[model samples]
Target: MNINGLEKTKTFSFDRSHSAKVLFKRPDKFREIEDLSKHNRTLINTGSNLSYSPLGFYKDSISVKLKKFNRIIDFNLKKKEITVESGITLSQLLNFTLLYDLWIPQLPGYPFITIGGAIASDAHGKSCALHGTIKNSIKEMTIFHIKNGWLSLSEKENKEIYNLTIGGIGLTGTIVNVTLKLEEFKNKNFITYKTKVNSVNECISEITKKSKEKDSFVYSWNMAENLKSLGKGFVFQNKINDDNVENFKFIPEEKKNKFLPFLPIWNKLTLKTANWIFYYLNNSSNHFQEDDFTSVIFPFYGKEAYFKFFGKKGFYESQLLISENTIEDFFDEFKFIYKKFNPTISLFSVKNMRGTQEFLRFEGNKICVTFDFINNKKNILFMSELDKICVKLKIIPSIIKDSRLSKKIVEQCYPEYSRFRDLINNYDKKRIYKSEISQRLEI
Candidate 1:
């Protein structure tokens, strides 16, 4: 079926090479779990379709869109918990919760991402050092399996399946509903502070200090335009407002007139110019400021201009989590690779993270670095080389952000890879739930 007048077959990524047949299904479409379970064809669940990778794309499989499942089943103010359908977007959740002075602690940069997708990837936020991944906020979830029917998994009940599903990438089953723990807030404003760092080493040092200080939120951006000063950037620390304020504004909505349709040939030059301008503007305004928490949380949504950088070919994002012990070495090699390839990187961000104990987690207290580049053969080769370096350093790449990572790299980087495979095989014996990513990485 068509969505928003878009074709049933469509490309979901910035990369024009990948495309899939989309099937839109409402919540009531599936009268029972057995309808999907007993089907002969493979299925994959999708929501918002914001994934940078091919996790939601499958050429031979039917994709189940969860947009119609969006709803708020219940909210318990006393417990500060909300039960929402999996298709509900984070933006919707925030808007609803804000009215009650409640908040979801872990939110990604994009508000359009769905709660189910967030939980599937175990997506983290700038406040990860304090709250960990989205899995930390999930109280429980209801998943539909082909063989098991409907299962309610939680930390206390069906704990193994719950942990596996957190970062399972929707391979185990379809996430239908979720109960999330929320934080109570007096106001929606945030007290933000920014500090400039001269180098990658200094950035790491500053992030470590901020983590120790237990900052509510911490993240850094690399504003350098060239290899000579690749890590010269700013560190941001923010805290939730403690007192209620009059006339507190939510984050500003996006203006369509602010963006121009992207031209493929000009993408590289446009991004370079944009990055330089962004660096200049941010560097000049390195000062403390107070703003709405929504502003700080969803910065990317405010500007649609950055989307033009991908052009028609789209982009690939590599997010690596390097252990604190090997961070210096990783950065040294990273610089070498960046200088050697000089890929058309549109964005670079770094965040301090205390790794989770989950089986698929990027273990150890580490620094997470993300690089966004235009999709091309040369850039793909460079990313492959970077993957090799990560493997050598024992650092793990975020599978959710990766599209081209091979099974060998995954096996080498994640020690629990075999265990994960075994669990999926045992649980999804029919292999009914599938995706391009799961098929590629043999998840």
Candidate 2:
């Protein structure tokens, strides 16, 4: 079968400088996992390459595209559970679930991301303090290994493999299907309030206070215009609007043409101007508004136009999860670095995170902060310095966001790295499932 001409092609957003030819495959063409198990070729499972990390791209290896397996295999309305193929996109899942008045409590900012990709990256959302990551909602999953045809994993069955694969970056095997528990809400509207804050400390305080509410989603954006108003930004708190029955009728489709196809080159001046404008817009008026689920949950959808700001080099995001005790110190150092380097940082966001799991998990109650900067040598060096500080403070950098992280940095950041690697080696002794990130990080 012709797999859409994917053979001998390159994965999307592959590093321009890296000349790696990837051989692609579609599982639907094969009747069973045993078909590929005998081969020694390195096989890397891939979904939509929505991750900023190079988890899906492989150099001169077989890339299995799971997109063709997209389907809703089963649904239990009473249990509010659905089993879906890994390749189903978030948008598709949401649409299907909304028809039954069900919702996935946690979702990333982007809707195009595939379910398998979300679970592998352990993607978090604005309400992570309450719902945790996507892994929390998954009841069970079916993963296919070269040696093991199909293994069933969950909190109770094959729990070790389950833990490893949740944030395992697809090293364990190719996730085939997932059974997820869905949440039910009376309405799909959110009463959103945007409050301007003067500093990162205030932002954290506001987020903490808002997160105390039973069902509130809170996040903050830090302005990067200038040192005079550094860390000044807006905090958004959104609660489910109980009174909006009409909004619950259906999830609104994403707005079209809301963002330009391409943004102009980003520079200090342009970014500062954009930051000022955004701050003014948020602070001017109408701090309170009612928004549909799409607007509240996937706020950044249909905003691919921002990619143009990074120019031809693209961008890199450094996301850190700092414990409550060390958050202030982390921000202090972050601000200092921001002032010293003055890189063209386009965005900064903050959210609350709680709880912990074993393997590649963010331990303790912490706050997640992310910074996006145009990729360049100077900014790369700046990020390296920041990583060193993170290592000292015991801050955990998100492997899903930072593609440039070295193997040493990952080892230092994740204390369980050794054990995680051992699990991978034992599971796939031949190293059949490998990616650029897996090899680069020595996973």
Candidate 3:
């Protein structure tokens, strides 16, 4: 399992870069290894290595890759179910589903992410208000257990493992394949409505009410002075309808590929000003764009290597999922922190969630605050300040986004932290399937 182009590897200098000792890639040939339960090895759970956590945080075992295990095992059209290998990407799955007029309703922003990673993270999409997160669409999954070998799980068989595997972060075992529930669609026609709001509170109320009234997708933007630029943007609500007569082929092909080449490093100075203008337009616009699935999400996707956009300095995002009961106060306090730290935040969005049962599953009526900042001394200091604020407010930073927060902070934020750790310990006591974040949190 040699990594590709190590000597020529494009170096990504994030806070955790110093910790990544091994960057292993999977072999193209299929080889079955012996029992891996004995060692305290931790498998790297990165689908595309887009994570920002430190390397040594998890078990210092050899990093394994499932990239070569690509194939669609089966699909039941009548039942609207598809089973695929773990290496298959979201983009590949979407293209396949489109051909058959079937789709996985909840799609993460990045198309390159693997189904297994999405499941482990329990990724949520813009349409989560209507369809919930990715965990909701899981009908069944097959994981390669160390002692038990390949075990199939669902709501029925091995229900405990199934529940854990849904958002277990690949700790229970290696997710070799997964079976997903599909949404049927004869025509990919959707109605989109965009409207700007004055304040974060106003946007939240409108989004919550509108999202509940219809099976729709919603997202909000902020444009204000300093870092407290709350709710100065628009709310986009989209719903699939059967009456649209436009042909899907009528849409124009996307000209630029690979995220418009990530704006030159020298242009980093202009990002803030440009983003502010974009935020203003988003908040001011009341018109909606008729677009396809790809245009609707991928263009603004967080993938395409966000670190490269930050010039010599990379970027770090600390996302938190606050409880619904404390959302108002959370936002109020977040605004205060934004003003206090005065960090250069690139993009900020808010969305409402229903709930989930995954061990560390981020759920409930709350808003996801994602802070993007350039990797620098100032940015690092800002992160530290944010950590102090989160601690004081009892805010639980997302595991997948920000691993900078200490284990104590995570324990306070997640009510199920002990339960999640206990579940992992009971199953993989040796801690073979671990990551830098897991190690830091001592999961």
By TM-score, the best candidate is 2
Model 2 CA deviation exceeding 4 Å by range: 1-6, 14-19, 29-34, 38-40, 247-264, 362-364
Question: Per-residue CA lDDT of candidate 3, range 1-443, in tens?
Answer: 32232111222323333344464535344333233433334564445544454422233544555677667999888899999987787877777777788888777776676787788778778877677788888988888766567789999899988888776766777777889999876667676777777787888777777778666778776654464445666777776656775654322222235444444352334655776777676656658766565656554453444445665445677877666567787777667666766666666677776665346776555666666766667667877877766677666677677656678877876778898899878877666776666777888
lDDT of 2 at 227: 65
Q: What TM-scores do the predictions have? A: 0.91, 0.93, 0.85
TM-score of 1: 0.91
List of clashing residue pairs for candidate 1: 14-313, 14-314, 15-314
Candidate 1 local distance difference test against the native: 0.77
Between candidates 1 and 2, the one scoring higher on lDDT is 2
User: How would you encode candidate 1's per-residue C-alpha lDDT over 218-243 as one tens digit per residue?
Assistant: 88887545677677878888876566
Ranking by lDDT: 2, 1, 3
